[model samples]
Target: MELGYIVSGLFVGFVVGLTGVGGGSLMTPILIFGFGLSPLRAVGTDLLFAALTKIGGVWSHWHHHTIQWHIVGFLALGSIPSTLITLQILKTFQYHDQQLTYVINLILGIALILTALALSLKGWLINTIKANNSSKVVLIIRHLRSNQDFIMISTIVTGWVLGFIVTMSSIGAGALGSVALLYLYPNLYMNQLAATDIAHAVPLTIIAGLGHWHLGSVDTHILFNLLLGSLPGVFLGSRLSISIPDRAIQITLSTLLMLIGIKFIL
Candidate 1:
């Protein structure tokens, strides 16, 4: 069982390192279906795992100046509070002995389907947004921010919603969030978009992870073991991504997510 988790982490880590995608997407499912961990526990442990692993990626992006601090600030504005509220809700539900397993399964199923859609339509999504460029909306967002009005409030609210969803499912902050941001901030670069999303994700995951720890949903030992294997695997896999085609990787991962989604739904 232990070795199985380590191997799973190794594979997931490598893929994340290579493509910078599919860490929580793959790991949470493996923990639940492959190793038979509860969904609550799986998500809880994976949240912390993601936060820790992504630190390295964020640092790299920051060093490269790919992360747009303004966007990250906007995202964090909402995400921080949303995560806290979601954790509180989790706490309340657990206290009532609610069906954690069933709830987790439902959320996981939805997240997987969305992930599949995001992966499969990534190119179409990017092109569609670009084709329908909205300079007006860009100007509106910029002006609202510039004017120091309620846009900050709105951005935080948006972040809060996404943070709750991501904490529950480990699904967003990937292709889906990227797509939304592209539309909202048409002037943002792809690299900048990616970096900002990572920056937002780190804090959300940490709060969620801490909540899970309080709920006894995290397995510290397992988390450490998984990290031990994943860190190196991620490093090695990132090195290999250059040799692999991006489209092929996205397609394969999308197909995998689809299968998992359908399985859980049934």
Candidate 2:
């Protein structure tokens, strides 16, 4: 691979570190749609790339005692079996590579739309949750709990669909999933919500990455290249996050996703 190719990895890593978004959403699409990598290779490599990065994040959360194991369990409950079904889906269609490209295009479109919406709606959601703070949200915050069965069933079903989509497209697991969780548990403490999402992300990405590996889709060299930049990128972004504004980051990410989506669609 050329040093320029690795530069894409570094740039993507820097953006991911700065915004905590767009690992698969931006990277895989750029690889396939911009750089013209095969969709199969892009998805596989990005899956492993996500897993590796999230492991580091999970460790940080664990050390801080910030990980919400309960929420993670709920998300895993939804995502794991779905991941298996996704693996099966990939197996059936692995030979029909062209269709996979179309799917990637479609997913790139959807991911962009969702990320844009998430970016705009996140501020609204946070504000609304704060302004119209209801007893239900307040109660949940005071107790910091969720109904057991609801969480489990939701998790499994959510995981199932996301698993299939993410495995097929390498999109949705980041901003989309986080946004979904935020809506479902509108009352959740934001920190706890982030912690839960990251915790959930670990297993979801790992399972999908392994499945891709089994299918011979993963490109380990590419994955390592992504990690080389993303790890340090996260640290660099943290240093700058305080100075940069959240709304600006969100808007920029949304716009980037939109542009990428339009490119894929057209």
Candidate 3:
């Protein structure tokens, strides 16, 4: 049992539970920079870690009747297959290939920066959308409401983009997904939006994580350690989420991610 890894998991899981950001945004970088794991190993281990950690959230959200299954199905339609395809492509590349690792790190860095920006801008974006009910964006939303086909097609396309990014970096299924859903389902209750995102992420992460496992990138030992600490941490954090002032947390997290992102890019 690696004590440091367990502690790291506890911190990351607690943050995820409180903020609803994907664990990968924190855990993957922690593994790489904090623990000195290779980029591929960090991403692979974080994928499975995220998958298992989110299962409990699914049940809790389901019990509260918060999930939007139709949306989740639409997301899965594109995400699942894209994850598999991305995994297969990674398998063909030698794991130790410097170029492959560099590419993964590059993608991971960009994803982190985007996730931070998304987090920082989320409240403003949502408020802007809500405030401008008569704006052109509102016109687009109204059109989407009337056009189910276009909405479905757009949802699938978003899933495809998320799947590809998550497969490579174990990020995006939460922060980026939430931003997308906020635009796609403008009227969705914020709590329901969060629950739906969590529900969709479970299967996507599990499938993508298992694919990484098959390719020998996953570290079972590290995964176990993370789970051991994270399960309890998540429960505790979630219980406290309602009382915590989240804007401060989001800003702090976003700043940290930006620094990490810049470091990775360099």
lDDT tens digits by residue: candidate 2, 1-266: 65555677777777877888788887888678666778788888888888887787788778878776876776677678878887887788888878977876777677667777776688776565556456675556434425656656766677666776777777778777777677566767766677777788878888888899999988787777767777777677767877899888988888888888777777
What overall lDDT, based on C-alpha atoms, would model 2 receive against the true structure?
0.75
> Of 2 and 3, which scores higher on lDDT?
3
Query: For model 1, how does the per-residue alpha-carbon lDDT over 125-169 read when each residue is reduced to its tens digit?
Result: 566555545677545545554544464565666687778778787
Q: List residue ranges in candidate 3 displaced over 4 A.
A: none
Is 1 or 2 the stronger prediction by lDDT?
A: 1
- TM-score for model 1? 0.88
Give all TM-scores, in the order shown. 0.88, 0.88, 0.94
**Candidate 2 wrongly placed segments (more than 4 Å):** 133-152
Query: Candidate 3: deviation at residue 3, Å?
Result: 0.7
Candidates sorted on lDDT, descending: 3, 1, 2
In Å, residue 119's CA in model 2 sits off its true spot by: 1.9
Q: Write candidate 3's Cα lDDT for 88-192 as tens digits.
A: 889888455799889998999999999999999999888876775688876766767678788899899989999999999999999999999998888899989
- Which 10 consecutive positions of candidate 2 have the poorest summed lDDT? 137-146
Evaluated against the true structure, the overall lDDT of model 1 is: 0.80
